[model samples]
Target: MAEIVELSEADQQRKDLILRNLQESLGVDKLTKQLSTGKNIHVYWGTATTGKPHVGYMVPMQKIADFLNAGIKVTILFADVHAFLDNLKSTFEMLEYRVEYYQRVIKALLSSLDVPIEKLSFQLGSSYQLSEAYTQDVLKLCGHISQRDALRAGAEVVKQVDSPLLSGLLYPLLQAIDEQYLKADGQFGGVDQRKIFILAEEQLPKIKLGKRWHLMNPMVPGLTGGKMSSSEIDSKIDLLDKPNVVSMKIDNSVCVRGNPEENGVLQFFRFVVFPIISPRIIDIKGQSYSNYDEIVESFEEKESISAEALKEFLKAFLIGILTKVQDKCENEELRNIMNHAYSSPPELDTSELSEGFQTVLELKDMGGDRMKEIKGDCELITSAKLYQKLNTDEPLKVLWRVSAKGKVNLGHLGGLLQLKRLQALKCECSILISDIGGFLDNGKCPWNALEARAKYYEEALKQFMKAISLENVPIRHSRENQYERDYTLEMYKMASKVTKDASAIVEGNTLATHLCPLYHALDVHFADVDLLITGEEQRPFVILGQQLCQGIGLPSQAALLFPKIPGMNGERMSSSNTEQHLDPLDTVKQINKKIGSSFCEPKNVKDNVALDLARLIIFPLHEGKEVVIKRDEKYGGNVSFSDYAALEASFAEEIIHPSDLKPFVTEQINALLEPIRTALTPQSKMITAAFPKVAKKK
Candidate 1:
C-alpha cells in the first residue's frame, strides 16, 4: 500500500547490470544513487591463479564487462597472495606464471564476451600488498581480528581438509583490506566471498577507509551439480578444453529432468550462456525454437524436450562457446605468455608455517616412535606452539581418555568408532592416557586439582558464572519442573560461590567420590584440545567450559556429538540393562542369538536398534561395500544395498521383513566386531591396558 518509486534510464541500466547473475547486493541504494548522479563508480573483482580458468570463471568476467558498459571504472585483481595462503596446488615458483596465465586468459575471455579490454585495469596482489604501507595495515588489522573471527570469515573459500592453515586466517583480513587500498567504490566476486566482503564493509570504516558497495554473482554449478571448483577437474569444464572434450563432458553431465536448480546444464545456460549469448537457436526433431527460453519452457513442461535431447543441444552450444574461446586463448601472443609463465618459476613462500606453529604434519613423517613420544605427554600443554599444533594444524592429534572411572562406556566406545573412521580417512588419530587419576595422587581429592587449575582461570570463571546466571529457566514449558530441577538458581549460585571461595573446594573420602564436572572443563584447556568428541549428554558441560575459556582468549573447541546408540531391547544401553546391551567380546553365535531376540518394531525405523547397529557400526566398517542379505528363491534371493538409505527404505516399506533383516544385521555386527575382538585379546596387553578396569561391587 505504498507509492512506487521509479528509476531513471541510467540508474535502471546500472541496476540491470549489477543485478544480473548476482545473488545478493549490499548498499544498493548508495550504488544506485551514485549511478543516477553520473558519478564514476570504480569496481574490482579478483581470482586466485591456482587452477586453470574454467567455464565457471565466465560468470564474474561477464559481469565485469557489464560494469564497463554501464560507464563504471573496472579493476581486476589477480590474488596471488591469497592463492599461496590457500595453499593452491601450485608451488610458490608457479604463482607469478599462474597469474600471467590468468591475466591473458581472462583478457581473451573478456574480449570474446565483447567487454572493452582497454577500459579495464589489472593489478596483482603482491604489487601493493608487499608495500610498507599495506604491510603495516595488514599487521594493524590483525590486532583487531580474533583467530575465530578470521576463521569464520574464510570458512567458505578456504580448504579445511584437515587442520586449517594460519595463512587461511590472514587470507580474509587481506581480502577485506584490498578494497580500502585500491580506493575502489565497490568490489565483486562469487557469493562465497560474501563473508569477507561483509567483514570489509564493517572493518574498512574502522581503519579510516570509507565503506564500499558489494556485488556478488551466483556460483555456477559443475556438470555434476555442486559449485564448480578448479581443483575438481571432472566436476567442471576447463576453459582450455578442446571441443571434443567439452562436448563429451557436457554429454555425460548429470542434469535431472525438469529441475533447473539441480541441473547444472540449465543453470549454466541461465546464468552464463543466455545472458552473454541470447537469441539462441535450437532445432529439435525438425522443430525450431527462437531462443533458449523456448527450449527451457518446453523442457520444464516435459513436452517436446527431453534430458537426452537437452544434453545434445547443450553439447553443440558448449562446443561453439569453448571453440571460440579456445581459439582466442590459443593465439600466439597469449600462448607465448602462458608458456613463459609455465616455464619461469617463482620462489615458493613457505614462511607461513615456519613462523608460528606447524599445524600440518604428515603422519608418515612423524614415525610411530615420534607419535608414541607425543602420546606420553599427558601433562598439561600450555605452550602456544603446542596449542596451535592441536587447534589448527593437520594430522589432528586425538586424545582418547584412558581414565580409571570404569570400563569405557558405550558413549566413549562410539567416539572410538568415529576416530577409527577418521584414521581410515588418513587423519591423525591417537589415544592420550588421562593423567587426572595420576594428578589426584599428588593431592587428597579432585578439588585439589581443580583448585590448582582455578588460579589461572579465576577471573574468566567468574565472568562465565555471571553470564550463565542471566539465562532464565523455561518455566512455562510442560517439562519446566525437570528443567528447573536440573538447572536450578541455587546450582548457579553454588557455581558462582565456588568460583570465588577457596573454602568451596572440598576434600572427599575417595578419589571417585571427589569427581567434579568442573575438572573436565579445565582438562580441555590444560590439554589444549582442538576438537572434543563426546555424547550429547555432555553438551551442557562442554558449553560451560567453552564460555569460560573464551574469556581467557581461547577459542571454543569444535564438537562432534554422536547420539547415544540405543540398546538391542530399544532402551538406553547400560551395564545394568543386560538384555539391552551386548558385550564387545560376544561370539558371532551369541550376537546372532541376542539380535534375533531384540526389539525391532514393524514399519518403524525411528529408534530401531537393529537399524542403528547397521547404520553406526556395520555400514561404516564396510566403507562403500554393500551389506548383502541372502534369501531363498521364493522370498527374493540375494538382495543387496549399497548404502544405509537404500537399506533403510527397504525395511521401512516392508520390502525386507524384520525376520530377514535381523539376521543380516547380526551377521554384519559380528563381522564388524571380529577385528575389534581380536585386538582386545589377552595377548594385546597394551590394548587391554588402555581401557579402565571395571569396578566390582562389595
Candidate 2:
C-alpha cells in the first residue's frame, strides 16, 4: 500500500520558499493559506545607508525578487534615521545623500538580478519616521519598554561603544513602531532583525497594530568566513569591489579542508550562486557537480577539494556572477547616484594640538615621548599595570604598596587584562588594607604625613568641601547620624565663612564605609602619581581627592574619570552580587555554568553574558583572529566571526543560540586564561597566603 500526502498549491509554494535557504519563519503557514485564497501580501525590508552594498547585501535583494515573483507587494525601506543612529562614523548631513545612494543601488541590484522593478515600491524612513503619528507611536513604545529591552533589541544593529548613545535606545523603538506605520503584512530582513521583528510582533498589538509575519533569510558569511561586515573591507566583497579586490578577499578567506559548513565561499555557492544561476550545470574543468548536494558532498568527503582549488573556483565563479552588476554600475545614472552620496560635507577647520607636542613629533624617537604617554590613578597602582590612556607627557615615577592585611581578589587581576593590552607600565606593591584604615596607615600610618601636609593649607579641606553641595553629594548608603554628624558639614560650615555662596548648611557622611578618598589622595603623592583614572561613582571621591590634593599641595584635577564597565546582568560589573563577577581563575566548567545560568532573554542582547564576554574577552584576546563555532548543518553549521560586533549582530539575529554560544565562550575562556593561569600560579599562592577568602561577621 502506497501512501500519498496531498499539498495545496499555495502550501507547496510556501514550503518551497521557506524550506529553501530560509532559517525561520513566523506565521508563514498562515500567510500561505491566505495566499491560496488569493489574498494579497504586503512585505517590507530595510537597508541602512552606511556603506557600500556587497554580495552579502545582495542576498536579501535576491530574496526580495523572489517575494515579487510570488505575487507579493514589496516595500523597500531605506532607513536613513536608523542608519545614522547605528553608524556613528557617518555625519548627520550625509543622511540624504546616503539614502538616495542606497535606493538607486538597490534598484540597480534588483534590476541586475532580474527582479521586477516597476511593481516594487520604495520609501525612506524619514518620510514616515518623522510624521506626528509615527513619532507618537515610537514614544508610546518607549514608555512601555524598559531601557534594557530597548538596548537589547538594538544590540545587533546599533554601533556598540564603551558609552552607548541615547540614540541607541531610541533606534529600536522607532523600528518596532515602523512596522505599525508601514502596515506591512510581512517583514523580510536578514536573520539579525529577528529580535527586532519579535519586538514588533509583541509590542505592535498593544499599541495599535495588526500582527505581521516575520520572514528571515540566513545571513551570508563574509569572505573571512564570518558574518559579512561593512566595516571590515577584507571580510567582504563589495558590490563595487573590482575584480582584483574580490579575488584578493576570496583568496585570503578562511577555507579549511573539508569544512563547507564554515566555509563562506561554499555557503555562498549554495545560497546565492545556485539560487540565482540555477538550471545551468556547474562545471569546474573536466570535473562537474551535477547539483548543490554533489558539490557539498564533494567538499564534505574524507579527502575533499583543497582550499586553494576552492578559492580559485570561487574567484572565477564570483567574477562571472557579478559581471552584470559591474556592467550596471558603469551606467551614468548609477555612477552619478553613488558619487553624490560620497560627496564631502562642508569642511571645518580642525583644532591644533596643544602647544609644541605636534612640533616635537621627532621626540618619539627618544624616551621623552614614552614618558609623555604614562598616566595613572589609585586604581592603577593597585592594578599593577600602566595603560595607554594614563600618561602622555613627562615621566612620573609611581610607587605601589600592598598592605599585608588587605583583601585581594583574583578579579582585580582579570580587570587588569584590558589595561595590559593598552601597554601600561606594570609595577607590584605590598600594602595592607587594614594598615591604611581611614588614611591611618598601619600601626605605622600615613595620617601623620597627611596631617603634616594639611598644616600648610589650614582651610584647604574645608574650602574644597564647601564648594560642593551636600544636598546632591555622592554617598548613597545612609548610616546612623548621617546628617548631623559628618566631616562634610563641619568642613562646609567652616569653609562657608571663606566662600561667597553660603546657602544654609547641610551635612552627610563624607567617607561612610571606607577611607578610599583619603587613601586615594595620599596615594597620589606617596606614589608620585598625578592622574587618578576612576568612574563617575568615584566623582565625590575625586572631589575629596581634590581637597586632599589642596592639603597635600598637589593638583586638584588629578583623576581622569570614565564610565564603569557594565555587568553581564545589566547592573554595574562591580555590584556587591558576586554572581555578576567572573574571576580570571575560574575553571572552564565553572565559567560555562555561570554564563549559562546568567540572563539571556531570546533576541535580547542587553546585559547579555555572552555579548559581554565577546566584547570584554573574546574580541580583545583574539583580536585580528578568526573564531569559529561548530554546529549541525541544520543549525547553520560552524559559523565564524571576525570581531565582537559581528558576533553581536549574529547573536542579535538569533542565528546563534545561547546553547551553542555558552560552549564556544567556554572554549575561548579557557584559551584566554591559559597563559594567565600559568603566570599567576606564584602570585595566586602569595595572594591566598596573605588574604584568604573569609566571611566577615555582621
Model 2 Cα lDDT, one tens digit per residue, 192-310: 87878888888778666767788888888877776888777887887777789888888778877556778887887777777777677776645676566877767677345566776
lDDT comparing candidate 2 with the true structure: 0.56
* Cα lDDT, model 1, residue 329: 74
Error of 2 at 14 (Å): 5.1
Deviation of model 1 at 677, angstroms: 72
Candidate 2: stretches off by over 4 Å: 1-11, 302-304, 331-336, 343-698
State the weakest 10-residue window (summed lDDT) of model 2: 470-479
- Residue range 1-698, candidate 1, lDDT tens digits: 43344679768977786777688988787787777667878988988777788998888888887888777898999987777655334444577778988987888777777789999999998777665467545644654555456667888897653445445666788888898778788989999988898888877675576788998888988888788998888889887888788888888888776567888888877777676665565476677766556767777874676778777766776677667777877778767666665563344333323112233434443443333444321222222334455443366544333232222223234545655554543455443333342223222212223222222122222222222221211111111121132222112212222221121122332212112333444444444444555555555545544443432333444444556666777765553355557655566777788888877888888878888878776676567888788888899898998999998899899988888888888776665556545544443444244332445747
TM-scores for the candidates: 0.49, 0.49
Residue 249 Cα positional deviation in candidate 2, in Å, after optimal superposition: 1.5
Model 2, TM vs. native: 0.49
